[model samples]
Target: MHKLGYFYLPSGKQIALEISESTNKYRYSTNKDKVKFPNIESIIKLFDQTPPFDNSRNLSHFEQIREFTIAKGGRKGFTVYIYECEFNKMKEIKGSPFSKYGDGHESLGLKRGSRVIGRYIDTGKKYKDKYVFSSISLINDN
Candidate 1:
């Protein structure tokens, strides 16, 4: 299983966190699997370098995030998963305007446990709508 970690945010604030590894190690079950999945040590280092919004302690092992949820401004009636970027480099790749509108890697939404280096925003208008990590970015601690 591939190790992935996530910190939950409500109203742009960190509440709780969870760390887990995938049961299927051969490949990601979803299209958004390209995002890097970090192991235990990498997770800790990332947290230490970035620090948590809540200043709460870090998870000791991999598991599920049970204490965090979507904030009010978030998509009002949908479920969202938050994760940390296991890898540091995420560059934008242009694709068809119809990208993510068909099937397979082209259409599948972000995996429930997938990690992205960007922040999330909800306009309270849709369930499958949110922003992606941008090419013009911030937070470089490598």
Candidate 2:
């Protein structure tokens, strides 16, 4: 198995993962914690990608907005909005995209207690959480 690197969680914990070159199966372990966590496949599915691997259709879902807070300094001279969201009523995670305009959340019409279909992109760095997405869009069901 080859190491793909670590997956960080919102709780500040990380999972070390290795994948088989031939089988593509993932093996993971947490850093000194024995807490039960999402399986490898589910964790992998949380990431959004481009063509061929763009499974946004399957991954994007209606996330109930719990609350949001505005923060500064994600990008140099830019503002970031940190959103607290829940998925499948099971997991609560923070999602945000660094914005030069400081209106990414407003442009999306996002508000507390609202539900919107959201897509995510991997930032490849630890932000508010391991699943921090670089961007999100409103999914039109029609």
The most accurate candidate by TM-score is: 1
Q: Rate the local accuracy (lDDT) of all candidates.
A: 0.31, 0.31
What does each candidate score in C-alpha RMSD? 13.7, 15.7
True-structure lDDT of candidate 2: 0.31
Report how far residue 23 has shifted in candidate 1, in Å: 1.9
What pairs collide in candidate 1? 19-63
lDDT of 1: 0.31
Number of backbone clashes in candidate 1:
1
List residue ranges in candidate 1 displaced over 4 A: 1-21, 25-37, 55-142
How far in Å is the alpha carbon of 55 misplaced in model 2?
A: 34
Per-residue lDDT of candidate 1, residues 1-142 (tens digit) = 1122334323112212122223344255565655334456755545554322232455433222322222322233332322123254332233412212121123235453333322332222212333233222333538
Worst lDDT run of 10 residues, candidate 2, spans 61-70
